[model samples]
Target: MSGLDETLLDDTEATVRVRFVVNGRKVACEVAPRETLVDCLRNELELTGTHAGCEMGACGACLVQLDGRAVHSCLMYAVQADGARIDTIEGLTESGVIADLQAEFHRRNALQCGFCTPGMLVNAHELLSQVAEPNREEIRDALSGNYCRCTGYEAIVDAIDAVAKARCEGGGAT
Candidate 1:
């Protein structure tokens, strides 16, 4: 067989097995070489909290923590995350890692349509973990990638700022 034929054969091969520790649970699934991590998480693993918006890296709707860092799930192939630790909104919620953020979002009415909430919360969690006390401008800068079509970002920024203050004061809420 020619080299091109070999390449074609490889492309037509069966699904590849990918493994990850998701939400403190071990998960393994077979995915096509082209299957994105968002598809794997939502379709294969049945974790739908991670939304797929724009299907590109520009939108942060498919954000998930990969190996302790937020990443665009829609841009990463499942095979690329093999044997990695993945955390979707479901995982973070279950772990109570973002409870304060969730509460602040609710109190501030930061979320509107709920489509971008998961990604926003995930990114906020990541930002807070990195910078305990980020100003409003810094918060906005961090959320520049995530797009929310519902409410103006004022409430979101307010919520994050409130959370930051609460956390610093050890109150956990504003």
Candidate 2:
């Protein structure tokens, strides 16, 4: 095929093989070019911790760490994430990086239905990394994108704030 034909051929391929590190383990998948990362994780890998909501980047329920940064999995294509490091909620739990935050979230009643907990934890994980001692306002701002229908945002804010305070004081699991 000529150069233009090859380009079109690559674009029209039904599925692309993507290889990446998920949660710390390397995984490879053959996914449709149009499949979103969340779909790949949920459908192909059976990693269901990343919820599907809004699917347009508005709701943060599908948040995951892409290359150490929080991103909406629903908004990212699986092929686009090839060769990248992806960390789902399960990975964070296995690593124990979010143990303290999870404990605080439970203690402070941060989640009720638990649908948004994973995304909330993912975003909270990012915030705690950037700011060791975030105030209530800062915590609220960090979690603004995640929506919780059960909790009124107060408990979630308290949980994140408590964890931030404990970490800043050097008593946290950091």
Candidate 3:
């Protein structure tokens, strides 16, 4: 191993305490300096809905709402989010903020294995939050970062579009 690698390895066992508001609850935990947020959320916080796929952030399976914006948890260290507000799929589901979207996705059968569903839902929630009504192309573009191996993405896009239309018709109630 290189000299710097060896030096850094000595601190692998070290832990840092971090506090954050997760899913409308205050939480604090000790984690290693290099521990990714995905690992902390899944292991320490037990928020398994945030998958750890593609730790390098290429896959959006680890997507979560950090400070009200969609972020790849796999790309962020737990310590970096010490004071942020994080919302996982579990939180969103419990709050029923995305109920319509979830219903549409289920009705359209937009998922198969369900591994990528959480991230897709988080991304979709974020998209709809910013753009009340997004076209199919816009929905597809927003979902470009999230990869779904089970479905062809056609159903997912259709679901999002339907939700957008429904929301608009419902007097912009999201």
Model 2 RMSD in Å is: 2.4
How well does each candidate superpose onto the true structure, as a TM-score?
A: 0.94, 0.93, 0.91
Residue range 1-174, candidate 2, lDDT tens digits:
445545647566578899999999999999988899999999999999999989999879999999999999999899999999999999999999999999988887888999999999999999989987888888888888999999999989888888887887889733
Worst 10 residues of 1 by lDDT: 1-10
Q: Candidate 1 — which residues are off by over 4 angstroms?
A: 1-8, 11-13
Better of 1 and 3 by TM-score: 1
Cα RMSD for predicted model 1: 2.9
Q: How would you encode candidate 3's per-residue C-alpha lDDT over 129-157 as one tens digit per residue?
A: 89989988899999999999989999999
Among these predicted structures, which one has the highest TM-score? 1
The TM-score that candidate 1 achieves is: 0.94
Give every collision pair in model 3.
none
| lDDT agreement of model 1 with the native | 0.92
What lDDT is reached at residue 149 by model 1? 93
**Using alpha carbons, what is the TM-score of model 2?**
0.93
Model 3 off-target regions past 4 Å?
1-12, 171-174
**lDDT at position 47, candidate 1:** 96
